[model samples]
Target: MTLPGITPYDGKTLPQSKAVSATNVHEARTALGNRLRELRQLAGQTGKQLAESLSWQPSKVSKIENGKQTPSAEDIKDWTRITNSTSQATALLASLRTLETQHAEWQRILKGGIRPRQNALAELDQKTRLFRVFEATVIPGLLQTSEYARARFAESIRVFKLANDINEAVEARLKRQDIFYRSDKRFHFVLTEAALRFRLCSPEVMLGQLDRLMSLSALPNVKLGIIGFETQYTASPWHGFWLYDDDKVLVETFSAGLNLAQPQEIALYATVFEELASVASYGRSARGIINRVIADLSPDDAEA
Candidate 1:
């Protein structure tokens, strides 16, 4: 799904410069800041005056107005109230929340390390009854083995310079897997064949992960589908996304995580998912593809 100000890219190529860049979030923040500034000026209050009235540091006002800082919901409310612009509070808060959702940078989210992020996801997992996941490259987190998960986390730590909480993060991730036994929840995972071949982790670790996928596929509550290279595609596998029931769709990018809750956005993703799922191989067919990958990894022990 496209974020505000960003143009949707064609599946074949990267978006051109005319398309909104990653700075959309910052630009959105700047626009909101300008609106707040207008409210203050219309109320005849200088930046220092507004800060003094709100009992905030003068720099807080300047940073916010300059889009260097994101104001919390309460901060927006206070600012609007003091400026006698309470009527704008609703719209301003909505903008702030949207910015927060669209600009959840991994660096900021993982500032406290990975475990907290894992815990937060677990909380969301507890609330979701059905998980519809599509992975274009790597295994989905819920279906990942500890070794595979550790490899993924290590890359995150390296890229984002996060704390070395790999052990705690891995434990929390495995804890989330407990939900797989609940029986009340359902999971449908669609993965492209490329997901199996990616060398994100060592061959041995990936073999274990493939074996885990084989076992998980047999669960009554889980449906695993693999889109082999031979399958004719009905939809372009542009990227991976997770659909938590019909409430929201989560898309992960290199820099940020997008949380989309708009009804239209969810509908679009659901439609694309069905198109991809229709072309995926399931049951024995899916297992055959996984087994082939396993054999390729360990040709000497295909029986193993």
Candidate 2:
């Protein structure tokens, strides 16, 4: 599974398509601003008049209406009440929530620890019918063993200075793996050779994790592909991303998790996934790559 004329990854940061996340966020804000402006106009109030009624600066009203500023919950409530459109408050707040979800800072999201975040993702897992995952550095969560997941969670707690909920978070993540058994769902995972060789966990734990991957790959609904170091990739695996059906692309950065739902963003990720998958080894070839990594980890056993 190799393609000619495509450049291999040069171990540099490839230009990403994630800029669309910011664009979509701005567009959503502008639409929300337009709705608030319409409400004010229908109430026969000028921007100055409304700002005066709410005891806010006139420029504040203008900024919110032009999407230059985000309105707080209190601001939304006061604006709706003053405009005599309190009925729109609920809908408006829902839109605000959607905006907040698009770019969640890791600190704010993990304030309560990682268990809640795992539960939230579990809910999403329940709804997604097709999952297309590509990983460049570490194994995807669904296929990780409990020991490996614990190591990952412990690192998160240490980095974020978060409370030690490593045990609970590990349990929740393992529970999410239950979705792999569902016959109605489908999963396609592509991983770079680095994911298999990375020493994120101890050798014993990684050995167990590699065994888990070998078993999971045999599931009828699961298709696992590995891009070995020898293969030339058609697309540079800039970063890992999860595509949920055709609806959303979830990207985890160093500071924030970006939830991209714009059609173009989803399409771009889908195209990249296909290109990576094209050069990946599946079935026996994929197993051979995993076995080589496993043997490298346990040279004594290999010699025996």
Error of 1 at 19 (Å): 8.7
RMSD of each: 5.8, 6.8
Instruction: For each candidate in the order shown, give its overall lDDT on alpha carbons.
Output: 0.88, 0.88
Cα lDDT, model 2, residue 185 = 94
Any residue pairs clashing in model 2, and if so which? none
**Which pairs clash in the backbone of model 1?**
none
Model 1, 24-134: lDDT tens digits are: 566778999999999999999999999999899999999999898889999999999999999999999999978997778787889999999999999999999999999
- Candidate 2 per-residue lDDT, tens place, 112-167, comes to 99999999999999999999999999999889999999999989899999999888
TM-score of structure candidate 1: 0.76
Task: Give stretches of model 2 more than 4 Å off.
Answer: 1-22, 26-95, 299-304
- Which prediction has the highest TM-score against the true structure? 1
Residue 37 of model 2: what lDDT?
Answer: 100
